[model samples]
Target: MATIPAKYFIALVPEGKIQEEATALKEEMKNLFNLKYALKSPAHITIKMPFEWNENKEDKLIYKLQKFLAGIGVFDLKFRDFDRFGRRVIFVDVLPSATLQSLQESLGKFCKLELNLINELSDRAFHPHLTISFKDVKPKNFDLYWKHIQSKHFNADYQVRDVALLKRMEGRWKVIHRFPLTEA
Candidate 1:
């Protein structure tokens, strides 16, 4: 018998007002533009890109992540308006914070050294943003959507107290574990 590998990623899932605002924006994208793929998962900033591993080794991976997060402290995050990667994707802009950058870098190093998961995408550079809509937005509609929401305003500030381990199951990504940042 063969085992199927499971996919996982680490992310900061927004809470309270930030989550609500991001959810509302996703709803607007669905209703107005008929784009909804980003809604498949909750709003978050990807600290580590998706990586695959055997199901049997999941416990070890989780243990490593817990240890890594235990050394991190809660950090403040702020979002404002909208931004995009060319015309292909649109997202809520996350202001660059040294704390966020440092956390991402440390996660990349830890994943490589501890889990043997070397994520080139996350390792190369990190552009932290909360996606609003992508993958489903057609090229023709990209401009129209971008233009319509370009100037729309949204502001949210929240503390990232924990990191979530989301696993792809049956095709949907769901939060399987949460490791809180414990250090001051």
Candidate 2:
């Protein structure tokens, strides 16, 4: 018999209304630009980037995450307008926040020390944004997409009450568990 490892990542995923809004934007991106890669996962600001871990050890991983995350205080996030990573990516712009940075840094350190999950992606500066489009958008059409997206408006205030651990299941990502934020 053989076992398949599960691909996992942690993120602060807001509730229904925000997800619906983000999903709609993602759908619009696919329709307008013929790029659908962002549709693979729900809109989220990544806390711990994807890592491979043995499925048999998942319970242990979840337990540690639960313990670590429950001590963190819940915080509010403000997102206003749209921004891009050069021409390659367009996202719902997140306002500058110190609390968000602290949460991510704490989670990153915990993942490294406790879960032994080291992600090269996380090594980069933490920029929190709910992506609307990335990678699949053709370079030539970038200006067009940017022009189109700029015409669209997205702004919201969301509270982070819990963090989700998602597994890359089947073909797309699915939330397997949520660890709530508790004031320390």
What is the lDDT, from 0 to 100, of the residue 122 in candidate 1? 51
Against the hidden true structure, what lDDT does model 2 obtain?
Answer: 0.87
Quote each prediction's TM-score: 0.94, 0.94
What lDDT tens digits, residue by residue, belong to model 2 across residues 1-184? 3566889998888788889999999999898778899999999988788899889888988999888877788888998989999878899989988998888888888878887777466445788999999979788889999999899888899988899999998889989999888854
lDDT of each: 0.87, 0.87
Candidate 2 to native Cα RMSD, angstroms: 1.6
Clashes of each: 0, 0
True-structure Cα RMSD, model 1: 1.6
